[model samples]
Target chain A: MANIKGAVVVNKERCKGCDLCVAACPCQVLALQPTEVNDKGYHYAFMQNPDACIGCASCGLVCPDGCITVYKVKL
Target chain B: MDINEIIKPENMVYTKPRLMNDNPMHYCPGCSHGVVHKLIAEVIDEMGIEEETIGIAPVGCAVFAYNYLDIDWIEAAHGRAPAIASAVKRLNPKKMVFTYQGDGDLAAIGTAETIHACNRGENIAIIFINNGIYGMTGGQMAPTTLEGMKTSTCPYGRNVALNGYPLRIAELVERVDGTCYVTRQSVHTPASIRKAKKAIRLAFENAMAGKGTSLVEIVSTCNSGWKMSPVKANKWMEENMFAKYPMGDLKNV
Candidate 1:
C-alpha cells in the first residue's frame, strides 16, 4: 500500500467524549486520551496513530458534535 | 508534518458546517440529535437557504436546536412544531420552513398536528427523530417505542397489549395525499450520513418547489435514555429497531 499520511483535528473543548468517532475509525487511529481532560470534564478523542488514517472522514461523519476534522496527504 | 499545514483548505476533507453555530450542543454524548443537526445545517448551507429558512423547534431534548443552528427559529409548545411550522410556511411562503421534532413530541402529543399538517399538504419539511423513548423526560416509553423494549416507564419491557403497538409514523404519513416525500434514515456511519444529507436536501428542495409536505424520519439512538453506551446503542438500534422501522424511502412523488 502507498504510504498515505492522514491528520485529524478534534475540537478538544467541544467533544463530549462520546467515543462514537473512536469506534467509527476503521483504521483504529483514534483513542480517548485518558490523562487529558477537556473543559467539559470528558476524555476527548485524539489521534493515536495519524499516519494510518485514510481520510475516510468516518470519524467526522459519525461525530455528533462536529468536533472531528480529517485531512490527508499522499506521499 | 505540522498539523496546521495539513488543515489548510487544499487538504481538508471535512469541516463543521458554517450554518451550525459554535455553541456546544447539550445533547448527551453520542446522541443522534447532534448528527442530525449538522446534516440539516449542511443541507441548508448547501441550498443557500440559510438566509430564507425558518426552523420550528420542538419541546424535546432537541429543544435547543435553534441555539445550535444559526437560523431563524420559533420555539413551539410540546407537540406543536408541525402546527407552528404550518403557520410559518403559510405566512412566509417564500421562506423554507421545517420542524425538528422527537418521537414523544411528534407521535404522542403532536400526533394530531403532524397528521393534519401532512394531510393538509402543507408546504414544509418535518425532521422526525424517532429514538423510541422520551430522552428529556427520563427515557419514558414513547408512542413509537418498540414492543418488548425496556424503558424507564416500562421497566419490564413494553407490553404490546397494554402499551399498544409501535407507531410507524413515516408509513402512516406516507399514505397521506399531501406528502411528497418520506424516508427513514440513520447517521450511524459515514455512508448513512451522506445518504441522510441527500435525503434532507431533497426534502428541502421538495418543500421549496411547493411539492406539499416532506417528512424525513431518522431512526436514531438515545444512549443516555437507552442506558447503554453510544456504540452499543447504535448496534442495538441497527439489529432491533431497524427490523421494526426499517430504512429507506417509503414514499417519493
Candidate 2:
C-alpha cells in the first residue's frame, strides 16, 4: 500500500453522534466527544487519532449523516 | 505534501454526493435512510442521469425524498409508489424511475401494487426499506416484523398466531417472472455500503435498460422506534433481522 495520511472534516451541526463512522473506521481514528455536544445536543464524531487515518474513507462511506469529508496526502 | 496543503479541493479524496444538498436529513441518528439516499444520489450523479430521472416518494418517512434529492418527483399515496412509478416509466420510457418505500408502505400497504408492477415487468426500480417495524408510525409491528419482535402495538412481542410471518418481499418478488433483479442489502458497515451502492447502481442500470423490475431491499434499522442506541440497533438488526431476512442477491439477471 502507498504511504498516505488522511484527515476528516465533520459538520458538527448535522452530526447526530450515531457512532457509525466511528465504528466503521479501520484505524479507530474517530470517536464521539464524551462531554461536548453540538447545537442539536448530540455528541458529534471527531478524529481521535488523525495521524492514524489512512484516507480509506470507510467512515465517510458508512456515515449516515453525510457530514464527514475526507482528505488525503501522499507521503 | 502536508495535511493542510492536501486539504485543498484538488487533494480531496472523498466528499458528499453532489446531488445530496446541504439540507439536513430528517431521519434519526444512524437511520439507514440517509446512507441509502446518499448512495442513490451518488449512483445518479455518477451515471449522469440526474436530468432524466424521476423518483416516486411514498407515504412513509421517506415521503420527503423529493426534498432531499434534487430531482423530479411524484408524491404517491400510501402503498401506491410502484403504480405511480409504472405510469411514469411507461410515459417516459427513457427516464429512470424508482420508488422509495418503507416496510409499512411497501410490504404491508403497497403489497399488491408492488407485486403487480414487478409481475408486469415495468421498467422501473423499487428501493424497499424494510426495518421490520413502522418507524414513522411509532414502532408498530409491520408485515415484515419478526415473529417475536416487539413494537409499540405489539408490546408483548409479535406472536405468529396473532400476526403472520415476516414477509420476505425480495424473495417473493424474485419469483415473479418480470423482475430482472432482486437483492437484500444493509448499509451499516462500509463494505456493505459499497455493495448496496453497487446493487443500486445495477438496479438503476437495469431500469434504464428496460430490463424489467429491479427491487433493491435494504434491511434497515429503526433506532428511535426500536428504542435502542444507533450502535445497538445495528447490532440487533445484524443478529435478529439478518436471521429472518438474510442478505445477498435473491435473483439477478
Candidate 3:
C-alpha cells in the first residue's frame, strides 16, 4: 500500500484553478498547469509534487473551492 | 471526461491560466483578498469572459490584484475603481467590466466615486472585500473599521464619539438606484464561501446579461490587523465581525 504520507490530494472536480492554493502553500508544492476540465468546465489546480507537502493545510484553507486535502505521516 | 468529474480541485490548475507569475502581493496571511481574487478568476473562467473582461484594481491590498487575475486590468487611483470602471464600460459596452476594491478604498476615499458609478447604473460587477481594517499600509484604521476596534492609527480603540460608527458599505450601496444586486457575505467558513461564490457568479451573470451594476461585498478578515492567527482570525470574524456586517443579499434586480 502507498504510505500516502505528506501528500497533497486535490479533488480536481472542485478545483477552480484560481492559484490561491498555490499562493497559500509555503512549501511551493502547488502550481497551476492547464491539464483537464472539472465538472465546472474549468481547469483544476494540481500539486507539482505530492511528497513536498508539509501538511500545513494552508492550501486547503485558502482554496476557495474546498478541493485540497493535505495528509501527513502517522509519525 | 465528465463535466462533473472535471470540477474537482486537482483539475482546476490550468484551464485558464493568464497572469500571476510576475508581480508581488502585499496581503498578509488569512487575508481573504486572495480568495476574492480566486473567485473572480473562477467567475471569469466559468463565464468565458476572460478575453473580453477588463478589471479595475483599486488601492489597498487589491493593488496587486491585477497580477493574479489573468484578464486585462488597469490600476485605478485610490478608491476610484468605480469611476474607471464606469469609463471603461462606457467606452466598450460589449466588454465585461468589473472593479475589485477593499473597504478602505471604496467606503473611505472612493465613496463618492463608487456611489456615483452605481447611481449612474453603470454595467459592471463590483467585488468589494471588507476586511474591517485596512490590510495594507500596516493595518491602519479604515472607514469600515468597527467601532471600539483598535488599528494602527487607533491603538486605543476607535471611539464612536471621535470616529463615529462603522460604515456598512453593502447596505449603503444597496440603496443606490442603479445597483441591481448587492449582497454581503463572509468567507470564513466553507458554507459561506460557497454562498459567496454563488452570489458572485450571479453578479457576473447579472452584469453579463446587461442587467446593471451588481456588487458583492465579501466580509473578509485581516489576521495581521486583528492580531490573531489564521484559525483564530476566522473564528473571531464569525464572532465579532458578523454582527456588524450581516451577510445576505441586500438587493437584486
lDDT for residue B41 in candidate 2, whole number 0-100? 95
Cα DockQ of the candidate 3 complex: 0.08
| Best-fitting candidate, scored by DockQ | 1
Candidate 1 residue runs with Cα over 4 Å from true position = A1-3, B1-4
Candidate 2 structure lDDT: 0.92
Window of ten residues with lowest summed lDDT in model 1 chain B: B1-10
Tell me, what's the RMSD of every candidate?
1.1, 1.2, 9.1
**TM (chain A) per model:** 0.91, 0.94, 0.77
lDDT of 1 by residue, B64-127 (tens): 9989999999999999999999999999999999999999999999999999999999999999
User: Tens digits of per-residue lDDT for model 2 on B1-253?
Assistant: 4557667887687888989988888899999999999999999999999999999999988988888888889999999999999999999999999999999999998999999999999999999999998998788999998988889999999998889788999989999999999999998888899999999999999999999999999999999999998889999999999988999999998
Q: If both were scored by lDDT, which would come out higher, candidate 1 or candidate 2? A: 1
**Chain A of model 2, TM-score against the native?**
0.94
Model 2, B39: alpha-carbon shift in Å?
0.2
List the candidate numbers ranked by lDDT, top first. 1, 2, 3
Listed in order, the DockQ scores are 0.82, 0.81, 0.08
